[model samples]
Target: MPTIVHTIRRGWVYSPFTCEYCGHEDQGAIHMKVGASAQVGILQDYDDTRDLAMGTAHGNMEQAGDELIALSPCPACGKRDELAVKSFYAKAKPWIGSGALFLVVGLAGAGYLASEGEPEMGLLATSPLLLIGLVVLIAGLGKRLRKLPPSAVFRSRNPEPWAHLGPERASQ
Candidate 1:
C-alpha cells in the first residue's frame, strides 16, 4: 500500500477561525499562494540514512524531492503553487545570464569549428571557452525542454508529483 507523506504544514493551510464578536467558527483558507523556491543541495551520500530503504528510494526518484521537490504550498489546506519557480529563475538570471551568454559565444565557436570540419582534437583545443559555454548551454537547454510550451502548461493540468510512496520502512 502506498502511503501519503505530509511535506507541507497543513495546520497553517486550514486553520479554524473564531469570530471576535459572535464566536462563530469558520475554517480559514490559506491561498498558500505561489512563493519563491528554496535552494537545495545535491545529496552525495545514500548509505548514511536512518532508513536505508527511504534513502535508496529517494535517490532513485529523479523528478521530485531530488532536484525539484513537490510544489505543494500547504498540507492541511488547498494551498496551490507555493513554489514560485519562474520568479526564482527570473531573479537568478541577471547573474546567470552573463555566464550563459559567455557559454553561447563559446558554443558558437565550437559550431564554427565543426562546420569547418576541423579535426575533433584540434577543434576542441582551439576554443576552450566555447567548449565550456556549450556544456553550460546544453545543460540549460535540457531543463527548458523538460517543461511544456508556455501557453498550455498550467492551464492544461497539474504537473505530476515526484513520488507518491517511498521505500517501505525497515521492519523494526
Candidate 2:
C-alpha cells in the first residue's frame, strides 16, 4: 500500500495598518499552524479544522472597530495617530511542498548513488527528477505571485479621527 501522505496548512489572514503619527503602515497578520492526517473515512477533519481557523482570524472587525486602534508610537517612524483607517485582509499563497519534497528526494537519491561508487548512474538517475523538481518549484512560486482578495474595510460610525484610541487616551 502506498503510504498516503497528506500535506496540510493552517488558515491565516492579515491586514495593513498605517500609523497616524508618521503615516507608517505595518501589516497585521494572524496565522495558526495546524497539522493532521487524512484518513479515508475522516477527510472532513481537515476541512473542519481549517474552517475554524479561518473563522477565528476573521473577527467582527466592524463591531470591534476600535480593537486594532493603538496609541503607541508608530513602529516604522516613531510617530503617533496618523495610521490609515482602512483595513484589508491579506492574500493567501499556495503551498509548494511537493516541489520541495521532490527536490529533496532527488538529491538524496543522487548522493546515495554517488557514495555507492555509481557516479554515472547517479547522475543519470537524478538528472530528470532534479529538473522536474525545479520546474514544479518555479510554477508554485508563480502561483504565489497572484493576489487574493482581502476582507472588506471595517467601517466605523464614529467621526472622530482619534475615536479608535483606547480609553486611556480619551481623557487626553
Best by TM-score: 2
lDDT by candidate, in order shown: 0.38, 0.50
Kindly list the per-residue Cα lDDT of model 2 for residues 40-154, writing each as its tens digit.
2344455565555444434443223232334233456654443322121111122366777778999999999999999889989998888887888778777666443232232
- For each candidate, give its TM-score against the true structure: 0.29, 0.33
Superposed model 2: Cα runs more than 4 Å off: 1-95, 148-172
lDDT over C-alpha atoms for residue 26 of model 2: 53
lDDT score of model 1? Answer: 0.38
Q: Give the range of the ten consecutive residues with the poorest summed lDDT in model 2.
A: 84-93
**Clashing pairs for predicted structure model 1, backbone only:** 10-76, 35-84, 103-133, 106-130
In the predicted model 2, the residue pairs found to clash are 18-83, 18-84, 19-82, 19-83, 20-81, 20-82, 20-83, 21-80, 21-81, 21-82
